[model samples]
Target: MFGGVSGKGRTGPVLAVLAAAGGLVVFGPAGGSADAAAPCAGRPVKAVGFGAGELRLYKGNGYACAVTAAKNPGTRRRMSVTIQARGSAPAGDSGAYTQLAGPVTVHAGSRCVRATGAIAGGGSAQTGWVC
Candidate 1:
């Protein structure tokens, strides 16, 4: 059964799917600077506790990136993630999208970010990131 309410004050439909599937699932709003197109940066992703999850990120101006996790090959358990970046992106391609990653454990009374991998194209990869 679902145990807690998210930052949004309710368990969304996506979470319900995870609970029914009997595996860990993580999700959160796409993080980054505020730009007109920034909202398209990433789409929500889902994964089974043991299988790999695929995260699709959309960059402004039609560029996009996909982040995938290698199979855990370990015990199935609850997973959490946190997504962060150096700064926000500008209105156009001139803006820079910094580090983005998460899939870490959620601490007591805290939520996980849930993003993982590099910013998008050829940038430094973030640490403790998961999707």
Candidate 2:
């Protein structure tokens, strides 16, 4: 007889429809959510201009104070620069640290410093300066 399509077979389509509806409920557009971007968006100023000719260090108000130099020919050096954070200084100083390869010299009255080394893959020399 038609005993093959008896108990469980008749409910298969219903179960499938329920499963599909459940899936829709779980994965619907209304249930989806988006992620927000981080508070710190742009590249850190210290991470820019590595292996270049010179680098400039600025205070919170964008006042330039120091410069970094590129690595000397046939020489390897690690250079680092630190700019104190605005109003966060231990003794009322605020700036940032931009590092580059060196032989770095901060000349008097100069607006940039030099790092004497090859630029690493991270877009900065290994001066160990923290922004």
Candidate 3:
């Protein structure tokens, strides 16, 4: 399983994490510098960059997860992340955040998956389709 979030941030930033046992772990705007790491299990398979951040995808054990991490994290800003398995509705998270957006996930048992993310309303999309 993947460990704690890791991205740009201040030293000794606050953190909150849950066990990545096929579940979602969300951290709110924490104190001091707004930087944290990406939280998810599995090996990274694909990533798409944006103006201010990036969308990363991971896969393992027939499951996949996605994350949107900001390149610069300090001020409160808009962020969003989405992941969708083919034939299923997409899952996403968006709001004013200091650091990152989501670790949106899906069960991709032999199916293709698409992920999208944005920081400050600017971002990119990916059709990994890593079947």
Candidate 4:
């Protein structure tokens, strides 16, 4: 269940998919599917910790990104995905809002962006800032 709105006031049931698990989901505007990478697509860029969870890195569509297949434990718990452009503060992170299931895909814009995922008290994981 997502709980926030984008600046455009657009919102829906977007699902966060885990890249390592090769999960796929198709929803309205809120959810869609992305390619899963074994070692990841394109040249291995960078990767960071995604809490206790696992993550995969990839590059496609002129963008570098990290994908995760995370599902809510049915306890009303929420997972968050964030993306920060170069020189941007974590507080300025812009990405998917908190949701029940995460296949959160954070993309790098321009120079590079840092991506992160986390659950309540579950810590967080991040990716190396890259193209």
Q: Model 1 Cα displacement at 105 (Å)? A: 18
15-128 per-residue lDDT for model 2 (tens digits)? 677788889988876632322311122222443345443444332232323334443333343443333323333111112224332221222232322222333322343323
Tens digits of lDDT, candidate 4, 1-131 = 34453445343333233332344333323433343323234544554555444444555555554544344333444456554557655422223333322333434455666666665655667676655
> CA shift at 16, candidate 3, in angstroms?
26
Highest-scoring model, lDDT: 3
lDDT of each: 0.32, 0.36, 0.75, 0.47
Worst 10 residues of 2 by lDDT: 88-97
What candidate 2 gets wrong by more than 4 Å, as runs, is: 1-53, 57-74, 90-131
Tell me the lDDT of model 1 at 94: 19
Per-residue lDDT tens digits of candidate 3, residues 1-131? 22454666722332323333223424545535323444767778887887888788888788889988888888788888888888988899988988878888788887888888888766555646666
| Best-matching candidate per TM-score | 3
Error of 2 at 69 (Å): 4.7
Worst 10 residues of 1 by lDDT: 88-97
Candidate 1 structure quality by residue, lDDT tens digits, 1-131: 44544556465765777776654323444446355333334433333222233332332222223332323324332322233322322111212222212222222122223334322232332233232
Cα deviation at 19, candidate 3, in Å, is 28
Better of 2 and 4 by lDDT: 4
